[model samples]
Each structure stands twice: as structure tokens, then as C-alpha cells.
Target chain A: MEKKTRVLLFKPGLDGHWRGIMTVSKALSEAGMETIFFGFKTVEGVVEAAIQEDVDVIGFSVHSGAHLEWARELVRELEEKGARGDFLLLVGGVFPEQDHEELREIGIDGVFGPGTVTAEIVRFIEENLGRKVSG
Target chain B: MEEMEEIRRGLEEWREAKKGWPERREEFRTDAGIPVKDLYTPLDMEGIDYLGDIGFPGQPPYTRGVYPTMYRGRYWTIRMFSGHGTPEETNDRWRLLYEEGETGFSAAVDSLTFSGVDPDQEVHGAAHEVGKEGVPLYSIRGVEALVENLPIDRMSVALVVEPMTSAAVTSMYFNVAKERGLRKEQLAGTTQNDILTMTIGYIPWGSLKPADLLKLACDLIEYCTAMGEAPRWNPINFTTYNYREGGIDAVQEIGMGLANAVAHIEELLRRGWKIDDFVHRLAFHLSAHRDFFEEIAKYRAARKLWYRLMKERYKPENPDAYRFRFHVQTAGSSLTAQQPMVNIIRTAYQALEAVLGGTQSLHTNSYDEAICLPSEESVRLAVRTQELIQEETGVANVVDPLAGSYYVEALTRELEERIWDYFMRIEEMGGVVEALNTGWLFNEMSKAFNKRRRDQECGAERVIGVNCYVMEEEEPTPPFRTNPRAAEIEKERLRALRAERDNRRVAALLDRLRGVCERRENVLPVVSELTAAGATLGEITGVYREVWGIWQLPFVA
Candidate 1:
């Protein structure tokens, strides 16, 4: 039996913009990935859960313009736990395109901004994780 | 009967003649899925009576305009929703908008303030979002700084907070007005204390149960309007705009709004209040979306439906209770991030729809809002967009200029029936509160989100920059950055306030608040005193959560 790629998604901080993250979660699930939606969590809590669940991808969305701050906090939490390279880190939300490089520099593996299609995200996950997502 | 027969015969000939010409698409429908014909004639308006259905302005069934003179007497107030970084910075922005000819002010608070959490709270890194989404008004001092040196006595201000913190934040604003030598009765403002905003529009953290939220919402209306505490202030504005931005069409938008208003009305009535006590002070906030004619008809249908609801159900004696006055905001969901300059044109057309629909107030979205908060220059352009409509365009000169158009009148009649039908469906589900508890409203929102995503992906709904006329690679606009030291500054302000305020007095008042919550009484009188004594939002709402436990939403992915 093929092991299904597991992905975990959440909303970091207290921003209430959940449509973007929920849409991505449903899309990934439809594309045949084992997706877990941890609704609202702290960076430290999300890191601990991702490691315990053995998820291949850990994604979070930010629409409160605190993308840089949250991205840095998540990276720091993972590094402190010696799990920086254990999972593919992704961040998506309503942020400027110029911030993509800064987010990547902060150790984020995938950066999706506004106007992102769900298929593009599905393709990104499959290509990066080297697993074929069957729908 | 003879005249109607003649027009019907002529319309049949015209329909046959139009069959030879090729149409643009196989079918035409409004954004709400109402089928549209190639042409509308006098026959389409078959049973609609002018006097009974579309009466004169300011009369029953206000289909034309709410007021007799509409924009001819005075143009709609340009009330922009704005805030950022800190209360001081937000005040500066308010002054800029005032200088640029804005008539009203609206405060947009941050997430910490929205959820009744202070920056120093140990929950979920609340400090990171201190001043990120909007201005942080944690304590009474922040609200005072937000309206400092402004003519709040003359111009109306809108505090956009929801049920969880509406009592706390609104009391802070009222206390500030009183200290500034303005009587509470003389204050003119609005509190966006809608329950659905926090529940369905955008789910806040630590939200109360739906029934508890209703109690909090009706408490404000009971305090300000029914109790005559702030006679001129609009205690609650049913903000349908927030939910519409979540991808619902115009019909669902107004349907949900009407049902939500009914929930509050029933709650107040159950509390032993007459219908006329707070019904006249009820107001609405609507959205101006993509469909040009449909949006215009929506405003008209909404006015008529409100009049009908008041007449057939409540029958308030006050004439003003029947008037469905609303503020329209250009749809933020319609704007695209690619080729951001095109959002200017989109906003302009939507603004015209509001003007023609006879809105009482308007707010135009900035072109760069799809990416980040608007830059100073971009916000200035947004204010100018509304100015162009009022100054350059002659659309607002006449009241309800398109009142007699065949397409508009017919569409208005069609929409009224459809919206009422949808409203009844909600009423059948035991009204809005029961629907919230059953997770029915959330299901509607989730379905809309998925359907919209599918439509855009398959090219069924063509967004200019996202689907068609794509731009390969372009220079990104310079994003506006918020103050980095906002969190530190706000925390310091809170610390200073705690040291200066009388802690013993605040604690006693908090104890009184707990008793009020236990007995389920109005919290305004005690909350006003607490805010004046320098109690923060977190402290006031913390008591409510302790008394009535937090709600666990029946949310599914």
C-alpha cells in the first residue's frame, strides 16, 4: 500500500481570515492527500503537532499583514526543536509579492500569495514532496 | 387592459425579430442566478403598481429613495473605514481624510481588540497582531487618542466592533465623548454590533454562544436607543457587507441581513420592549458588487422589503422605522491583485451603482487593497474616486434617476419576491440564532466559497486580471508597512494606565459586572464606568467568558 502524503494546515495568530486557508485544505484533501486542519494554533503548538503526526507538509496562512513576523516565529520554533528540515514549510495569504523572497529567506519552502489557484498549490506539493497525488 | 394587450402583442413581435441575431452567450443571468432576458418591455412590469409597489420617495414601500430630495438636498456622506499601526496614527489618517473632504469617520480595530484580548495576554501570541489589522483600542486611553483634536461633536463616527466587544469598545467611545464636554444625548455615531459578523462573516477567537451574542447585541440597542442614553447614536448597524465579501450574491446578502435584523427585534421584544422603541434607530451597511443593474435593483428591493417587514409584521408607528437607509461600500472581493491599476476603474463603476441606487453613505476601496493595506497615496486616490462621482459626474443630481427604467423596475420586482422567499427559508430554520447553532449558516458560507473557486478556475467567472488578460510579470507595487514598534508602544500604554488608575475602584466595578452577567442584565451602565476608570477590553470581556463559557463552533472542513 502506498503511504499517503500527510499535510497539516492552520491559522497562526489571531487573524480571522479563514476562507483562504480552508479552501486550500479542501483542495489538498480532494487531490488525495491526508490533510489535517488545525484551526487556530500557536507556532510552538503547531510545530509539536506536525512532528507528532509525521506530516510531510506544514502550512499556515496569514492575512493580518504579520506574515514576516509569523514566518520568522515558525522557523525559530522548528529550529529550536531540531526539526527545521523535517517537514516542508508553506505560508499562504494576502501579502505583497515582494515579500515572497523575504519569506523564503526565513526558511519557508512554499510562498503562495493572492490570486493563487488551488491546482497550482496541489502541483507544488506533489512536485516538492516527490509523491503523485491521485484524485 | 386595452393598453396592456397592445404592448404584449408588440413584445411578442420584437422577441421573434430578435431570434435571428446571434447572442453573446447561450444564457444570460444575474450574479444571483436570476435569468435575464435580451430585452425588457412594458409587459415585463405586468402587475407592479406604481403607487402601491413603487411609491413616491419617503413614503411607504420606499422603492425610489428613502428621502424625498435624496442627493439633491445633500450628497451621501463619504465614511471611509480606516485604521492602522496605532490610535495616534489612525487619528492622523482621519485628519488627512477630513482635509480631503471626508464627512464621516469609521474606526477599524485590530484583531486583539476585536477578540477582546490585550497585547499583554499570554494567549496565542496576541502581541504579534497588536496593531497589524487595525488600530488597537484596548483601553479608554486609546479611544481618547483616536478621536483627539477631531470634530467628533459635529461629524458622525462609526466604531466597527462586534458583539464580543461591542459593549466594551462602545462604552469607551461614549465615555470619551462625555469627558470632552459633549453630552451623551448629543453624540452622533454608530456601533457595528452585528452578531453574524463575528459568527459567520469572520470567525473570531473566543466567541460567545449565538444566544449570548444576541443578548450582548440587543443590550446595546436597548441602552442607546430604547433607554435614551445616546438618543442620536445608532446603536447597532447590521453590517451585511462583511458577509457579502465572503462570495455570496446580492440576494443572499440582503436575505441574511433581513433575517439577522429580525433576530435582534425578537430578542428586544422578548425583553419587554415595544417595537417602536429601537426599530427607528436600526440601520444597515450593504455592498456594491459587480453586476451593475442587479446591484442597483438590490438596493431598491431592499428598501421595499424593509418597508414591507415593518408594515406587515412589526407596524411601528414611527415613519422613520420603515425607511431602509444604508451605507454602501465598493466590493473588496471584486478587486484583483494582478494589474492592480484596473481596480480603480472597477471601483468607479461600483460607486456609480451606489449613487444611482440612492445610498446614504459610501466608501470606495483603494486599488492596492488586494495585496496589503492601502498606502497613503492609494487611499488618497480612493477618496478621490468618490469625489469624482459627486463632482465630475452628474448622476447624483436627480433622485432615483433610473426609477422608471423598464429593466430596473422589472428586476426590482423580481428581486423582492426572490429575497423574501430566501428570508422565509431562514425563518423556517428557527431564525438566525438557531441556524448558527445548527451550523447551517456556516454551511452556506462554505458552499459559496467552494463554488466561487470552481467558477473562477474553470473560466466561468472571468476576472480581468486573474482569468483573462493575464499579465505575465510586472513590477510589484510598494507595500505600505505598519509601525514596527506598535506592539511595544501599546504594551507600554497599557502598563502606564494600570499604574495610574485606581485598581480598587476597577475591581469593585468588575465584581458588579460579574453579578450583572449572572443575572443577565444590561452591562452598559457598569461597563461605561469601568471603561472610564481605565479598565481594558480584555478585563471586561474576560468576565463574560468566565461566567458563560466559550463556544465551541461546529466547524467542519
Candidate 2:
């Protein structure tokens, strides 16, 4: 039996937009990933859940302009705590096109913009996981 | 023999196609959360009435439109949601929009002013978000700067105001009109004074308990109607779009919206006012979402349901009272923040749906709405998108263009059945306000909203950026950057107003307002007085909060 890909999904702000995050969570689960959703968590709450869940991938979905700052802080915290290697950092939301390179430099492996298909995200995770599963 | 045949079929298909299912598979869900089958036929509709349900445009029930000629007679008003930072800035933008051929203005105020707080108030905090999301006007002086040199008589204005302390803002506009000597009848526009919709979305400013909110709402309705702002001052907009963005599907949005309307109508009728007197000015602000067919069906169902509810439930003698006319805002939630540019395409689709759904007026979400406030460049594109649809598409040439189509007609009926069923559920839950108070409505929206995320995560639904079409390297358009000093400019305007204006009269008018609100008396007349006295938005809201006691809901994620 193959072990499931454990994924944690969360929104990092009080902003009430749940549609994008909800759709992405559903897609991940249907792609055979085990998912736990932390609804609208604070910065501290998200980092705590990351440590507790010890998931393969941690995704933070937010539209507020705090993504770059949050990612940098999270990466710094993870590096200090020696948990940086365990999780692949994936970030998505109204990221300005110009900030894509800057976000990558902060340890985000994948960035999804509008017009992206679900299959591509699934493929990104599968490739990142390095576990080839044939259905 | 049967087993052998199945094996052979499977083998042949596997050989021909590497994957068993179609190569590009995606799950499609309606805006109403209805699962769409491969095809829908005439059998789906079963029974539908064209004349009774849709009718000729500009006729009874108004399923198509309230006007006979719709866009053919006159185009839907291109009302840009303006007003951000300060009065002067908003006025400059308004003048530019008008010059660019916008027919009307829709003002979005900052949280402080919208909630009825003065710019200098401690409640505003250091981070004054004025002009960031909406225009922050402190007094009639601010209003003057916002609408300076504009043709108040010729151009229609829609102020996106919640009734927390809106009397001052509204009164200021009226005072300006009066100041310019424009006839009350010549002034045409809407004040989005819907306290219910504002309350539901969890605005942190001054809110009211259900009872007080209802009273304030009634006060505004009565004030506007009796003050003879008959054609203008659209005090009621049963806004369900907020619910939809919160995660309630189309059916729930419409069902709850109607229920909300029912509560208001019941309150007014109980007060001994005839329904016909107030129902005409009542309009709906609906969400024109991306789901093309579902949105169209939702509109059609809303018309049929509202007409039946008025005729059968209320039994109003006036024909016009039975008609349901509404303005549509393209779904802001549907636009992705990820692929920002693609939002334009998404907005176009939603706009097309609005046209097909038959909206009275439409406001397309600017492509950059998800990231920041729209710039003039983007706002123009949004308006031009609509203008293209009107002038070039030839879509508005006919009435209910898809009225009798098999797919559209069937979808319309299924939607109606589901909505009526949902309406019964709401009624069972003790109507709109009760359900809202109990968090039933919030829960429903949250559940669906969360489910959609789960589906996207599991590949059941495909959102272009988050789930599919992974972009390894790309550039997102630079968001329209606003001057960070917008709030400073607005604060200066407020400071200037304090130096000006009648201090003694303003104090007296504010006291009068407090007296009426405390007594639960008709406060509109006093509101007019307060505005005339140059009482600020914050002052009016402060008085209201002291009386009504702001609503503190158990916060929901």
C-alpha cells in the first residue's frame, strides 16, 4: 500500500475570501492527497500547525499584500527551527506578476496564478514528492 | 460470452487511449452548486410559462427588464464604483469618469466614514484606511469636494452607504443638490442604505441589533418615500451578492434575499403603511457570477418567485408592486488574484452572463480588483467591456433572447424548484433575520465555501492557477499603486471642515437626531436637518451607536 501525500492548507488572514482556498483543498484531496485545512489562521497559528501536522507540503492561500513578508518570515522561522527541509512551501493568490521571482528567492518552490489548471498543481506536487503513482 | 465481450472492449479502449477517461477531464458545478450533466434536454424543463414567467421586457413581473426598450431605448448606466482617499481626489476621478462617458457614479466610502466615524475619531486608529477602499468624507465640505463642478442634475449618483450613520452623508448630498438649486425630482440616483446586507458581512464599525437595525431601516425607507424623493433615493437594495461571496450558492442568495425583503415588508405593513407605497423604489442588488446558465436562471426564478410571493402571499393590489427590478454586480470573488489578467476574461464571461441574465444596470469588476483598488486605466477597460457588449454584440436588440431555449428554460425551472424549496427551509428556520442571527445563513455559506476549496484541492474542480496549468515562470501585471498619502489628504479635508461650518446649529441638529433615535421616532426629518447643519458622518453615527447599541456577532471564519 502506498503512503498518502499529507498536505496542510490554510489562509493566513482575517479576510473572508474562502472560495479559492476551498476549491484548491478539494482538488488536492481528490488527487489522493490527505489534507487538513486550517481556516483563516494567524501567522503564529499557521507555523504551529505546520510543526504539529509535519505534513509533506504546506500551502498558504491569501490575497492580502502580506504574502511576500509572510513567506520570508516563515522561511526564516523554519530555518532557525531546523524544520525547513521537511515541507515544500507553496504559495498562491493575487501575487503581482513582478513578484514571482522575489517569492521564489524566499524558498517558495511553486507559485500558481489565475488560468492554471488543477492537474498542473497535482503534477507539481507529485513531481515534488518524487513518488510516481499510476492510476 | 458477455465477460469475453467486456474484456475485449476494455482492451481495445486501453490500447487506443493511454488513460481510461477523457484526456482533459474537469468537474463543472453550477453557481447554485447544482451538478451539471453532460446534456440537458426539453424533458428537464417539464413545464414552463413564457408570458407568465419571463413576459415581454418592460411588462409585469419584469423578468426581462422594467423598461420595454432596455438597452435599445437606453443603455444600462455605466456606474463606476468611485470615491477613495479624499473628497477632492474622488471628485477628480468622477469628473474624469464622466468625461470618459460614464453615465452614473457609484461612491464607495472608507470603513471609517461608511461606519459613520469622523476621520479624527480614535475608532479610526492610526491606519486610516480612508480612500483606500472608499472615499472618506467628514462633512458637507467633503461632499462638496467629492462632487465639485459635477452636474448633480444630469448625472445619477449611487452612494454605497450602509445606514449606520448614512443620514448625514445622504443629507449632505441632498443639501448639495439644494445648494445648487437642483429640483428634488431632477436628482436621480440610489443610496445603498441597506442595513441588513451591511450587518451580515461583518463590518466592524457601528452595527445595530436586529430590532434597532430594522427600525433604522424603516426610518430611512419612510423618510425617503415620504420626503418625496420618490424616483430617487433607492433606500432598499436586497443585496444577496454578499451572501454569495461568503459561499452561499445562487439559490440560497435569492432565497435569503427574498426572505429579507419579506421581513422588511412585514415590518412596514405592521406599521400600517401600504406595501404599494414603498415596494416600487425597492430594488435588488444581485451577483452576476461566472456560471452563465445558472445566473440567468437565478434571475428568471427570482422574478417568478417574487411575483408569486407578492400576489399570493401579500396579495398587493398594485401591479407595479409585483414587479422585481434589480441591478447586477459582476462577481468579485470569481476573479482570481493569481492570474490577475485572466480576471478580465472571467469578468467578461460574468458580464456576458449578466446581459443574458437580463440586468437593469451592471458594474463589471475591474481586472485588478482582487489585488488592490482599481486604477483609472483598469476602470475604463471594465466600462469599455460593457460598452462593447452593448454597441457591438447586438445582444440587447431582442427581449429575453434565450427565453424559450430548451436548456435555458429547463435550467430556469430546476432553479425555481430548488429556490422555492430553500425558501421553505428559511421559513422553517423562522425567516431571514432569525436564520441570520442563529448563524444558520453563515454556516450554509461557510460549508459550501469550504467544500469548494476541498474540491479544488482534490482535483474535482479545477481553478486555473491553484490547481491546473502550472506556470513555472511568469509575470503578473503591476497592480495600480495609489498614493499612500490618500488618508492624509482626507484628514486635512476633515480638519478644514472643523475650522468652517456652523458649530452651534450643527450641535443642535445632532442633539435632535439623538433624541429621535433614542425615542425610536422617525429620524429622517432630523437627518435632513442634521445634514443641513453640517453635522459630520461620524457625529450622526456616534449618536446612533449611543442609542441603538452596536451588534457584536459571534465571529465566524
lDDT of each: 0.92, 0.73
Scored by lDDT, the top model is: 1
DockQ of each: 0.83, 0.12
Q: Give the interface-residue alpha carbon RMSD of model 1.
A: 0.9
Q: Which regions in candidate 2 have their CA more than 4 angstroms from the true location?
A: A1-135, B1-29, B35-37, B124-126, B555-557
Q: Which stretches of model 1 miss by more than 4 angstroms?
A: none
Residues A1-135 of candidate 2 have per-residue lDDT tens digits of: 777888888765323345566567767877788888776455456667778877788887645344676677668778876788778888876556667789899888888755445667889989988985333
Candidate 2 lDDT tens digits, B11-125 = 6666667545563436556756676754554444445566776678767666666667867777677777776667777888888888888888888776666667665665513
Measured over the true interface residues after superposition, the C-alpha RMSD of each candidate is: 0.9, 5.7
